[model samples]
Target: MLEMAKIVVQKTGEQIPVMYNPTELSLNKTVVLLGQGSNIQFQRVEDDDLTVSLFFDTYEQQIDVRTKTDKIAALTQPTVGTADRREPPVVVFTWAGPLFTGMISKLDQKFTMFLRSGIPVRAELSVTFKRVLTPEEDQHDQGKFNCRQLWLVRENDRLYMIAQKTLGSPDQWRLIAQTNGIYNVLDFPTREDVGRTLVIIDTHGETFNEVGNV
Candidate 1:
């Protein structure tokens, strides 16, 4: 099998850059625009000549829906058993596949990943690399890389799941956040803020003492 590791995405302008300067670039931070749409560029390094396959998680069908009058439909309602309205599966990434033809390179490979409604587009994940060779007993045939896990990117979060997945632990969140220059996680749940919290409470006895003094 092919030995694979976590894939890291460093953000860039939407237009793919023909070349990158490793010195000025941020290694783990990704930039998202504030407007309606954000452009993202991905940079990853992989062993040469390995085939990569893409898998999309299928969404579970919705079994319960409310009517316009606020009435809940019965479980036996015909719509419940009917074939679900198949939403077009958004294509997240399209590239050369080991589904047959092989061979990939170090240069920037371009592709697009699309998001569809009802799907959680943002997520945290653990990537486990595996090698699958086509020939049953061919020792020389190296394997391919598959997505080992897909997870959610919670709200009020900064780092993507890719960091944790790659590192095999959630503690890696700070490394990702610090690399991005986000000092306060309260504002954004980047690494610096993942487990940081503050709380306050008043003592009833202290309140009585103050009132009596007044």
Candidate 2:
């Protein structure tokens, strides 16, 4: 399993602090968040000034993958049907419990992000796992596990449904965190931060629109 590390959010303006309970959030819990759509950016005002904060949380865990025979093989290679699709392995997890409902009101409209700042805006959550180093433990194991990162967008209809089908799992949130570089996932947003620009990619893996000055 993965463990949650610290969370950090980068944005424009001054520094903003994040608050959490160290007891429940100790080193072993998997940090997660829930959403409705691809609009991952949000903002809020504090001290009469506009501050934007990117929302990302972190978790630490080891992904479990099983092996077959005694002869070791490169399991990370792509298969025939899945050939030429050398994308990163992604997992997404959902916070489907009482804590999710409680956090709704806390994040609503109390957030905002500037779209004009042209800065590298990022919100990240992370997970840190203990490293096991032993030959015997490696040879005879139930499965394989490793550190994985993912990029996190909002849980919209398209991504939410697509992830379930593509990844074959709905709550494997580590994939989302890996894609979005979220090591620390619960780093909340502020009022002065600006969101990153959107890049519209086409079917042939080409850019359809100009970036920044579009």
The whole-model lDDT of each prediction reads 0.27, 0.25
The TM-score obtained by model 2 is 0.15
Per-residue lDDT of 157 in model 2: 25
- Please report, as a residue range, the 10-residue window in candidate 1 with the lowest summed lDDT: 67-76
Tens digits of per-residue lDDT for model 2, 19-98 = 22223322222323345488542221111111122232221212111111100111112221355565222211112211
Q: What TM-score, computed on C-alpha atoms, does each candidate reach?
A: 0.16, 0.15
Off by more than 4 A, model 1: 1-162, 190-214
lDDT of 2 at 42: 23
Q: What global local distance difference test value does model 1 have?
A: 0.27
lDDT of 1 by residue, 2-50 (tens): 3222122112111111111111211132333233546543232222233
